[model samples]
Target: MLDPDLAFGEPVDDFSHCGTGECRVNTLPVLYRLNQVISESSGLADALRIILDIMRVSLRMDRGIITLYDRRSDTIFIHESFGLTDEERKRGIYAPGEGITGKVVESGQAIVVPRLSESADFLNRTGSPESERRAKAAFICVPIMLGKKVLGTIAGERVYRSRLLLKQDAEFIAAIALMIAPLAELYLIANVEKVALETENLRLRNELKERYQPANIIGNSKPMQEVYELIRKVSTSRATVLILGESGVGKELVAGAIHYSSAASEGPFVKFNCAAIPENLAESGLFGHEKGAFTGALAAHKGSFEQADGGTIFLDEVGELTLAVQAKLLRVLQERVIERVGGSRPLKVDVRIIAATNRDLAAMVERGEFREDLYYRLYVVPITVPPLRDRGSDVILLTDHFVAQSSRANHKSIKRISTPALNMLMAYHWPGNVRELENVIERAVILSDDDVIHGYNLPPSLQTSDETGTTFGVSLESKIHAVEYEMIVEALKSSNGNVGLAANELGLTRRMLGLRMERYGISYKTFRTGTPPRR
Candidate 1:
């Protein structure tokens, strides 16, 4: 019988036996057996046998049964049992809110009676006559807990009552139960995560089905969102948008969105990166190339601007276009018209222009590198996107998002990044910006052999042994020292062994550079020549 003090309501701890034999020696062996079974077993069936083996050898019970609570049916059923034939085991299963087991579950406490005949709740469906006789005999039933939840119970008849079932028996059972809780919890959590990951993957896949979907643009930063919002607003209108950002931040996606949402919603959305186009054929490509327009112009072909007539044309890296090409583009924007190369008769067509550039065209205009009038024309409704490093919190958010995404893409199941890997990601400055961050995340996800992405898998840029920030915090002297070292190095390299040249490179007079070098306690000769100065 279960000790009242060691009932299912409390964690059984105090172990003292009325008399010791099988119950005394069974605890360690039962635990070891459970470990062996769980290690060998793969699924629920194996898990049940693992538990059953514990009961058979440890408790010396005549028969043992485990019942799992069915939420939908509001009852318990036999997941599996031990010490009975397969048919008999199946027969021992009982409904919840029925029998002593059901009452124990409802009550949330272990109930053991010395005499089963006296118990009113004992609705015993005995396996056979022999089992029936055993059922009238003595037994112990304790709730199986996966943490605080009652998964079900372990119940059986004592084979031979040589010793009274004391606090020790319940303590040993609870020990096994306590150990099982964590495993069960892990199984439940892992299964839930797997399902959730799969569902998210399916949704993302469906989004990519359309020729144009917002999901194609991968960024969660506020700047990126602002770009998306602007695209969404003006997409329905005939108003043109000129995207402005560093190269590789996905400006074409914005243009695609504009086209998909505009009056020419069903029309084609063509893209042409201006910088990628050769200077010789730039105009012909913007307009159309007639047969023999150039030596390689084998046949008449429509350009991007013409192909996207009644639709939208995305002009990426527009700042790279030559002055001649810029003038033609200005004319195209001024009037919705395009002329095929060598063909006269102006081809008037309705087309929207969406332009993007990484260069500061205003500065270029000041330097006469780009046209001033064309700059004004293209600067209309400019949307500038911030670099990845500037967008705080978006880095890790996008990292997790990409990890989940790439995991599905590569048929992998990476769960998360290790702390060191995450620390590296957070600390490192992404100079290549969002595009670089995306590439790194994709690679990390692919290279992750374990569920956790470790620091070893991180790109070399993040692997700098500069753990200085963590230890030093913010020190003005350290910063100044680093800056001083950089300046000296620059001066030395630019000077090329000449002190005057080094001094001129530093924008300091030779006399001043010599004085400064002396003050810092260094000979100019030692620095220029790869030799240490005498102290």
Candidate 2:
């Protein structure tokens, strides 16, 4: 709110124009009040409202309204005003060039009507009563502009006793509107940008939630389907899950799916890698530590278990726990309580433990390295994540996923993978599993200059994993069959999809060539149509 006293600003006693008896309307007071309104306002709406209120009192204007233009809609509507109901404000919308006010905005000029009844363009969209409209003698409307861009309009009504007074009022309103135009345009731009950012934030959050769903885990093989079933069954209960798989086989992703799909999905999911924790810090890291519990322990800290009090705690590489820590963890699993280091009292924790390990915990227990009781407790809900080599055609699915992800992250436009490159990817024994595939795809996306990933774009290790002398467990018979199939397909392609010509080129009778095609699942006519050979 603008202070009414600021507009008067201690009246000037010595009048400058002394000859005339009629006193001049002092505008210095209005200018000072406008300055205060701009400086003391919190937002654009507040500034415009206060300015309109102050101008009404100083200039004896009535029914002051401020409208803003929407470029997408090509309309101008009253945003803020002194004398309008909510319904009336809604009715004040006007298309560009529709009425007198619209004409002012479309032409980027001001309009001053000396008699309200004389102007046929007036729509009376503000729904002012007939009595008030009759009392109003003059109407002044000006375009609020930023450079060549006309942003909106400011309009008011006043009693018309003299044309000179009406002209003076119009000039004063136009000057004030010019002063506020830039800020008004800035406010609209900032508001549009803010809305866009918030919408994008919501979209990304939804994408993250969908990514953690079990269906989006990216594998369709029997092994992965079995894993999904196990996750679904176990997610309904609070059982202790034990995820077992080779390194880089997406153990954490499975755990995340379980946690997010479970009954306690709303709770926090905390994760810690036992192998990454040092021997000295394992105890405090899992069970927390009290203030002054050890050297340099100045403040009390919540550990992984405490942080996951009502949720889930995923302890990766649980095989690395020492004998002493193993005993404490075993007690926690059985009793649902953990005592902090250097504290005698035990605190109850309602956390679900989802433990993972690449090493065989059963063997470790037999060797007296891991506790036998803890192994059985965690083994109650065991889930085995399959390695990449065992997942068959799922390699192509994962490859496509990683390619799309990497293309987006690197701002590249790679859309497809060459057939030879895909064949190499499928044949390689991925010792590093899915993680390695993702890294390879990211590297290829960064290194490739074209829209497609070619065989040469792959790292040398993957390129040689299949072709290096009886490597990758591909049997000699299988390789011979593949070579035979390729040679026959190429011969058919060269002979323009003629079976007899192809048979003669391969040194075989037509009957033998047909039998080989049936054995290899090859279709001879597909060659001339430019379809890839199926085998």
Candidate 3:
């Protein structure tokens, strides 16, 4: 609400500008008051309402309305109004070029209706009474513009007066509109960006949910099926889970699947590597420190447990915790509470613990390296993730997944792995497990130039023969021959076993290619039949 008799700052003494010898309005005082209102207002909506009030009071305007354009709906609706009921304001909606206000917005110009009764362009959409409509009321609308872009329109009504006075009022309103144009544009841009970011955040969360689902874990081997079953059963419960696996066996993936599929899927999933933290800082890292807890502790920090409240926390390599930290961990497991490093209060936490370790905890217990009570607490539901060598043909499935993934990431067009490459992948012992297989496939994808992963594209370690136990004796000449053999085979495959075409692709004469094929025991007939020749 605006005071009807609001003072427009101190009065100016000059009154000679008006030919009638009366100073009804001063532009400088009104402009200063508007600037003060704009600067003191909290936000765009607040500022707009007060601005319209200022115009209605200072300019003696009977009614004022500010309409903003909504780009999404392609409609202009009254955003702020002065001297209009809520119901009347709700009725003032129009499209661009629909009415006088719309025309001002569409043309990016100011419009003045000298006589509302005589003008056909006046819609009277606010449902003003017939008496007011028929009275000598004038309407003025000015487009609020940022550069050439029209954001909306500011319209007001005043008693019909001389043409010069109406024109002067329109100019004053247009000047105020220009002053607030930048603010309006900034508010609109911020709102659009906020909505866009929220939409993107939702999309990424859904993608993560789909990517980490148990069914999407990328393995169908019996061992993997068992792991999946255990994950499904324990996911619905709040029991502590212990995942046992050798290094690089994807214990972290199993933990993630459990967390995202559980009831607390929307909560945070925090992962802390116990082995990555130093032994001295282990306690403060697991259970956060107070602001002045240590020499360098500058701020209070929330540890993995507190940060994972109402969620799941994955403690990888849990066997690496020292005995003292293990005891504190045991207390947390039993009491569901943790004490910060230098804080005396025990904070309650509702996090589900999923611990993973490559070491044998039972053996560590016997050797007095790990606490027995803590081991039993963690052993409640032990899930052992099998090494890659034991997963059999699942390696082929994982290999295909990694190859496609790496190809897309590296902007390559890898069609398929060659038969020899597949054979090499299957024959490897995979001591480094699934992680190693992904690295191997990524390496092969990077090295492949002909859209096919050949045996020669693999690293030297994976090129060992079953009988020879080494990769072609590590000589430069042997490596060259290996690459040459792969290239010749690939050329034959691409040329559909046409000797002359294959020879041409390999930059060799027909006779020379025939000699080299014979030396490498390569037969083109098998390639013609779409069967890879024996190496």
Candidate 4:
């Protein structure tokens, strides 16, 4: 008889009473089936339920239950069970040291109750019937542990048998617990990461909603307002948008605005550069390929169209696609289906197409460079984004936006762009458009020494000679003289009126330096008095 106060029953460790041959015969097949079930199961919960079922069937256990400890709640609840009603399973909750199941978890040891009818520790929380409570029964429970940490417990009840048989059964249950510890731990970790990823995805979706709003696009110029109006009208529909603009003119940005503002905002927005894909792989890249379709194609792939199934796909530089690829794209536009490389079945895709190009697609079609049918299909709603040079004072607005962004990124405290720098930015013809403007601002912010972006911080390409009023075709001799004059002035300021020191700095003799200064009308006497001579 077990002690009433020690409700944990008996700890079963030595199974020597059970012969080795009997143990091997009974345990080997169970272990093999458990391995097979675990390998074939999709998730931890499913695997655990199947495992409990196996125990009930093979070990002749009347009931089996698996419980997991929730650190957040500081309690153990039935995670999986067999031969127990839903109500009974829900009643099987326990805190550490609360019941026999809890005691096994608290001590991280196996427990065997030889006779349920006599043991006072058998709580019977699941409400066993009077007849079953009076019947001969043996209960076995073992802690499921990962290393030294107890994660949960597994328990079962069988017909009361010989003590030797109960010991053998307890040993087998303990071994099963050991095998599942790693899986349970992995399931717990995966659940945590899945929750974190869901939170992050929600945050990003909200941010995109705010960021890609049509009103958020910078520029109120007449051209931009017209572009905004077009975006608003077509954003609610499923029409194919053909964005016409020079390279780096924010065509992709406009496409993004349309996507996020549309009804399909919750779906993916896939971007593919038509000119960037290699010619030989372009079809495979867009339509995907089956495993063993070609060399090095080890597994099946999902292409851009399939990936953007219920969403939008922005095909930039669409005019650069080869004729063969153009035909396939035309078929997709017409039939709404795509066939993988070396695949016969056509996979249907519901995707909104948005194509952009800097080239003249109308002329390309005439010259046989682009497909005529595809050009018409993409031209459903043509939007021409004006070049930056054409959008007058919008330059100042964009410059301020870029400055603020660059300042925060580079950890600078830039207050404003100097008047001269602003003038240069407004006056220049931006061949690279808004993209080039952003790069120039980032460069100036990194090179700036103080709170202001000066004219000198601007790239040389933006610098024009005041005398010639032009950036190009300046005389070589004039350029040399301008550079020399600045160098000599800087040298004098550094030397503080010491002619010999200034000369040494410029790697010139004192006489040569003095002669050049006289010609350039620079006087070292002014520098000696802590004043720089004007050029």
- Pick by TM-score: which candidate is best? 3
**Candidate 4 pairs with clashing backbones:** none
- lDDT of the candidates, in the order given: 0.66, 0.79, 0.82, 0.80
Ranking by TM-score: 3, 4, 2, 1
User: In terms of TM-score, how similar is model 3 to the real structure?
Assistant: 0.62
Clashing pairs in 3: none
lDDT of 1 by residue, 157-265 (tens): 6533322354445556656655565455445455555534543443343333243555556666677778778877786677767887766555666677667666675
Across 1-535, the per-residue lDDT of candidate 3 in tens digits comes to: 1112322233423324355532345546756766776676446775686577667666778889898776655667777888788656756777789889888888898877766777788888768776764567777899999999998889888774455556667777888899888778877787865534543454455567767888988889999999999999999998999999999999998999999889888788999999999998989988899999989999999988999999999999999999999999999999999999999999999999999999999999999999999999999999999999899999999999999999999999999888767767887899899999899899999998889998888887877564224345346888787777778888898888999999999889999999999988999998889986666
lDDT of 4: 0.80
Per-residue lDDT over 1-535 for candidate 4, one digit per residue giving the tens place of the 0 to 100 score: 1222323245533454335333436556657866776676556776686567667766768889898776555667777888788646656667788878889878887777776777677787777565664456778889999998888888888764345566667787788888888888877676755534543454466567668887888998999999999999999999999999999889998999999888787789999998899998889989999999999999999999999999999999999899999999999999999999989999999999999999999999999999999999999999999999999998999999999999999999999776446667877898999999999999999998878786567777776654224343235675566557656866787788788999999999999999999988888898888763554
Cα RMSDs, all models: 22.4, 16.1, 15.8, 17.9
Deviation (Å) of 222 in candidate 3: 2.5
Model 2 per-residue lDDT tens digits across residues 207-315: 5546788899998999999999999999999999999999999999999888878866657789999999999999999999999999999999888999999989999
